[model samples]
Target chain A: MAAQTLLLKGVTKIFNKGTQDEKRALDGIDLAVAEGDFITIIGSNGAGKSTLLNVIAGTYAPDEGQIAVGNQDVTKSPDYSMAHHIARVFQNPTMGTAGGMSIEENLCLAELRGKRRGLSWGVTRARRRRYREVLKVLDLGLEDRLKQAVSLLSGGQRQSLTLLMATLSLPKLLLLDEHTAALDPRTAEKVSHLTNTIVSQNKLTTLMVTHNMNQALCHGNRMIMLHQGRIQMDVQAEEKQKLTVSELIDKFGETLKDETLLSCEPAGAP
Target chain B: MVILSVLPITLQQGLAYALVALGIALTFRVLAFPDLTVDGSFPLGGAVAARLIVEGVDPSLAVAAAVLAGFLAGCLTGVLNTRLKINSLLAGILMMTILYSVNLRIMGRANIQLLFRPTIFTFMENMEVVRYVPVIIFFFIVTVIAKALTDVFLHTEYGMALRATGDNETMIRALGVNTDNATVFGLGMSNALVALSGALVAQDQGFSDVGMGIGMIVAGLASIIIGEAMIKPRTVFRLTLAAVIGSIIYRFIISMGLRLGLAPTDLKMATGFMVILALGIPALKGAREGKIHLRGV
Candidate 1:
């Protein structure tokens, strides 16, 4: 067995604790992700998929849990400090890059992720050449428009650039929160393909959240289904390969059905 | 050019206040922080410099101290906003209020006169030149250096993080940069420049009055608006140049208004109106267009 890349023990997050509107977003999630695992997460609305990623990324501190990234006790590490080990891509294309900055400038900022920033020139001649090489792999012709502002790029192009930047640093863990949900179907397909290539090429441990059951099944070596705040079904390798979309949806639909029935009625009240 | 020598003292004043405009540009545009601390820090600089100069300290040393004081004031405002969770505008207002009393205590009175004392403006006195020539040259040199330094700093690695902090803070923070510290640093640098200009202006006018910095922040905003109207600021170089160019043009307009018999007391209101017009027109037009689109829908 491979060493675990990220280990989560009894992670729980409660919004508005003790208030009448209090809700448990994540309920004691105990997950251990092994090295080079690409896991796809799918669940009903408000199922705590994103909450899990946020907890792992340190965007939201878990109310009760221990999050260890690479053997380090990082339960209290803040997002900015935790960035050295993790990088994330969001659903919104604009969230990953600065619109006002040029492509080269944005890439330069990304290249220094987890690195000390000092008074040296940000984008030097040599660094620009390296960036040109890094950008050429996208086949988006972005290398030719190094000075163009990111605001001018199309949504698909920006998302592509963002994906490149997120993976540029080769972080220990990459979190994608519905990264392709905002793009057009065609652009989403292209970006999905790119995501797979980048993940496999770098051997990066990744956790991706998606609404599409087909996407959840088609990609990732492993898959996990969340209901309420707990992992309902987790299929890996041989078990995951045999599981069809229909089976996955049937299991997912039953959970939704249970939730609606559970909410709409008081069992044995009548 | 001899035109600088032949021009009225308004040009020299414009050159001196150009530093204030640069500071405003750094805080307001680059850092996207609307710092009202300049109003207090400007006088803070003047008071510190004036008092130190009177105590027989080297004029240059006094000016440096003033700049340092302004930097600290700016940092306090940053801390209030980032650490204490105070609103940026309110933090600035609080710092400005505190600085008012601090400046008063530093001066020990309402004003300090450097009329008979040797100052930076008098450094070129030994050189034979046209009247007001030395002052204009000194201010022009300082403004240019300040502009150049700002441009260079913005292109550096640390500057890139600072610019990113203002543009998309979450993105930068995700890249392992502590945004709160960046905000504090940017505020400090901005106020330091404002204070530098304040110190020089006091020496030039031969008196540092407690009220000298009133409405100064608004004036800087007006200068930036006027300058941005002339040229699009796409790069850091053009952005800094825009502030300098804007300051000169703004001064010329103010000088022309004074020549046309406008009351000096009314100048602040006039500047306020200019800024409103400059900022409002584009926004109003956009809103009107948005309404038109809604009607079309």
Candidate 2:
């Protein structure tokens, strides 16, 4: 399995437990992500893509089974404590970085992630030079505006910056949940390109959940189609590379029909 | 001549209140939480400091105790919000309500008179100090230290996470930053600074009244808004300086109002009006700009 980087074994999560309107967000799901595996997840609105990512990121506690990052059991670890090893990029660009703080200050914040935070000088000249060098790699001219507020940046620029911030310390896992969904089409394309570049350069083990089918198939080394809180189809690098959008659509249709047929068949038909 | 004589005293008092305002700014502006616990915690500090001093504790030790007590009161509010899962505003109100009784209990009454009792001020009083020199120096030293500490803390890795919690709690938690802990710890530090201000105010005024904290948060807000209005600094150091300047201007306006036949009893209303003006002005300007656009359209 190329040495698993993240593992989820028979994991389940129930929101509002014991309540009449309780939701089974995840139902005994099993997932294993190997090192350098960039997996794209896709599903309908109510499907458990986000919920699964939240569970792995330690934002939500699973009701059963176990989750591990590498060899460490992080099933019960709290969010901030896990920040040292795991980084996440949100859908909203504004949510990833502090708006009022300058780009350098935000970069400084990302650089200090997972370390003992102390009261000290922020954004020294040397640090600013280093940040400029890092930003230059984006080819977006962000290096020239190091002192500018991050809020001034465009959506694509902010997302690109967020990607840099998230990977600054090179975390063990990177979670992207519809990160470019909120951006305009052009900006989304730019951010997606940036995402591909950064992920490949860093060799980051990534889980990217996207709504666009083409995007799901086009990027990442692997793809997983999720439905009814479980993995419906898993495709590896070689198979995924050759998988067409029409093929994915066909598989999705097949899965949907199978689910409908099983539901109609019986109450306990295994 | 009278104004000149009192200028230094007013400036000193204004600076001291700026620390309190900074504390308020942390919760209200930075964290975006309406923490009513400032009202109770402020007097709670005075009560703790005055009571400790009366029992012959060193002035510095008494002030430290007061800060610690304020921290606990703030943490109490956080506990109410996080553990009890209460609404943040109500959690602050509940803590404030409880703190009134706690302050009274600590003081053994409605007030603690520290007059003639040896205090930190006493040491300065005997050192050939000018009428306002000791207090101003004390205020300057404390404000600088507090401002520096705030700047450094906000810049740290954990501090950025704290700021991130306020910016977007859900995303921050998903990034593996504990939003709950950040909120609690931030609130604790905020109220501690406020209580420290209360302790210093008690020493300066020679008495700590249980009701002294009423309208304190409003006053603090006014200072912060006014400071931002005057010198809009993007850096943390400049932000703190703006807060201090805003406080001084606020006090100066209040004193000017008093001189212009404004009643002392109407001070709270005046403060409210000032805050409204500070908050409303920017909005009004933006609205005017919008109107201009509509006319052009």
Q: i-RMS, every candidate?
A: 0.6, 2.8
| Candidate 1 structure quality by residue, lDDT tens digits, A1-270 | 898999999999999999999999999999999999999998878999899998898889999989999999899988899889998888989989998899999999988887899999999999899889989989999999999999999888998998899877789999999999899989999999999999999999999998777677778889888888999889998787777765554555677553422232222211
lDDT tens digits, residue span B37-70, model 2: 9999999999999999998999899999999999
Model 2 clash pairs are: A79-B176, A80-B176
The DockQ of each candidate is 0.78, 0.38
Off by over 4 Å in 1: A257-270, B1-6, B286-297
RMSD of 1: 5.5
lDDT of the structure predicted as candidate 1: 0.87
The number of the candidate with the highest lDDT is: 1
Q: Rate the local accuracy (lDDT) of all candidates.
A: 0.87, 0.82
Expressed as tens digits, the lDDT of each residue in B149-230 for candidate 1 is 9999999999999999988988898899999999999999999999998899999889999999999998998888778777
lDDT string for model 2 (A67-168, tens) is 999889999987777787788888888888878778887887777666666555657788888999999988999999988988899888898899998887
Query: How much is B190 displaced in model 1, in angstroms?
Result: 0.2
